[model samples]
Target: MVVQTRADVGDKSQERIADVLRQRFADVGLDLGDDRIRALAAEVAGA
Candidate 1:
């Protein structure tokens, strides 16, 4: 779980990381599609 909302960071990179995490979670049978998981991941990974 990671999100980069830094002013110096790009949105695309952040999105890519998130998408990877989403996929990873799905692969492991986790529910990354849930808004709560996404929000938590955003907080944990975002700046």
Candidate 2:
């Protein structure tokens, strides 16, 4: 299991989280772009 702190995600802002996620996804061979990642992060945050 991978454990992550808020700082690992680049703070608690949804936008920042999305940015980190975009790069991470790319690192894992996922082509999820910034726009989609940001949108998904926002949804997760709102939930």
Candidate 3:
């Protein structure tokens, strides 16, 4: 697993974070839904 901070990705929006997470998951052949991705992104963003 890899980890990155908001500064690393250069964006703090939930949509952007979700996109990053979505791509990372896809890199490993795993697909997540929007709701799940958003939830995870929210957690990552501390929302």
Q: Which candidate gets the maximum lDDT versus the true structure?
A: 3
> Model 3 over residues 1-47: C-alpha lDDT tens digits?
22563545535887788888888888889888889888888777778
Candidate 2 contains a number of clashing pairs equal to 0
RMSD of 2: 3.8
Better of 1 and 2 by TM-score: 2
Clashing pairs in 3: none
- lDDT (0 to 1) per candidate: 0.53, 0.61, 0.74
**For residues 1-47, could you state the per-residue lDDT of candidate 2 as single tens digits?**
01242336533688767766776677778987667777767654553
Cα error of candidate 2 at position 6, Å? 8.7
Question: Please, what are the lDDT tens digits per residue for candidate 1 over residues 1-47?
Answer: 23332332324454654566667677778875657555644554553
- What TM-score, to 2 decimals, does candidate 1 have? 0.47
lDDT accuracy of residue 25 in candidate 2: 74
Which 10-residue window in model 1 sums to the lowest lDDT? 1-10
Please tell me which model should have the higher lDDT, number 1 or number 2: 2
Highest TM-score model number: 3
The C-alpha RMSD of each candidate to the native structure, in angstroms, is 5.5, 3.8, 2.5
